[model samples]
Target: MYYFFLDDKMLPVPPPKMEVKVNNKNKTVNLINEGEINIIKSPGLTEVSFEVMMPNEFYPFALYDNGVSNFITRLSGQQPTITYAKNYIDGFEKLKTGNNPFRLIIARFNQKFEYLSDTNMLVTLEEYNVGESSEYGFDWQVPMRFKQYRPYATKELEITTNENGEQVARVKQTRPTTKEVPKAYKVAANMTLWEACRRASGGSLDWKAVAELNGIRDNNVLKGTVLNLK
Candidate 1:
């Protein structure tokens, strides 16, 4: 038996059948002489397709009163739902906008109904399908699809600094900064004050200082204007 939960609340009706697909994308180069060359392989997206069944007995009171069609409307609406499973180990929060990514855990069940191997995935809901429905005592079928969502992790670097004349390794979040100070630079086409400072200083200069130095009231900088970088 498969169990589904939305956040802490388990879905009243669990779909009878659920399909999970893992996709991998690879880059190939084709030449006239050579047949093909594999350049790189990308961590592809994972998709979960399932049909939701809404029965009058299992549906919420609101849905049952308003009609089973409301169930499809709710799923198709902008609201997000965090889904997980009881027997299956994997779960994820469905989001409507932005980087709607979440960790997913899938657990295997044996003949005795005990969960065995577990697989974790990071994914997002890509799209969904609302198929034909039957109104025989209020029964509906809704299909959904989920894709993979991956975000780059930030890395920290430790630097040895002299604190109180003692060398110590300090760890800090690294951001782009300028190092070398330039005397002046002509504002190029499509150049912003922020970009100018970044180019003048290796990576340690701030854009605010540049703006203050140039007396720039607005962010827009005219092209071919030479500004002092001191």
Candidate 2:
């Protein structure tokens, strides 16, 4: 069985002999651990925890951060756009099908900021008229400061297998589904902003108008389902 754990210092540790089930058939597999494996559990941890699980051998992976919905509330002016990435086995294109196992990891992060202002000009008065004086002028400056906060998440994934092992090198993916806003059948979730924009422009959804209506800058969604882009 493959056991993962962390030390008191919160460093990830992957133990040998992890238990894995292939096509619903249980078995123990050995890890060809590349660099390091660290896992740890802290006391009284309610909100977050670190984890590392190897779904298969000989696969290099990366993480993807799905933007949070409430992230827009933290900033004053606008919401940030969400970025996506594809996780593929290192040099996957060169490998032959059925000779490689497609292993990947996904994660999410948020932007952090620090407020800095050197001038109180925002609160100071600007003389629209040279002869007229005012106590204050309408001025505000909100610059986006950014950092990354890797948050904790748990993902429930369905594993697909090849009974004949004929297409082992091919990437397995899920079927697409349409997304709607709270059962209203408005916004589609599973697509990128670009895709969503195109679909919403068709009149069934007002893709361009929603931003002005909500006073929201970005289109990052927090819905539980992924939107299927048609």
Top model by TM-score, which number? 1
Which lDDT value does model 2 have at 169?
Answer: 47
Can you tell me which runs of candidate 2 are displaced by over 4 Å?
Answer: 1-183, 186-194, 197-206, 224-230
Q: Tell how far residue 95 is off in model 2, in angstroms.
A: 22
What TM-score does each of the candidates earn? 0.45, 0.17
The 0-to-1 C-alpha lDDT of every candidate, in the order given, reads: 0.51, 0.26
Clashes of each: 13, 20
Tens-place lDDT digits, model 2, residues 60-107: 221112222223323334343322211112222222233322211111
Minimum summed lDDT over a 10-residue window in model 2 is located at 119-128
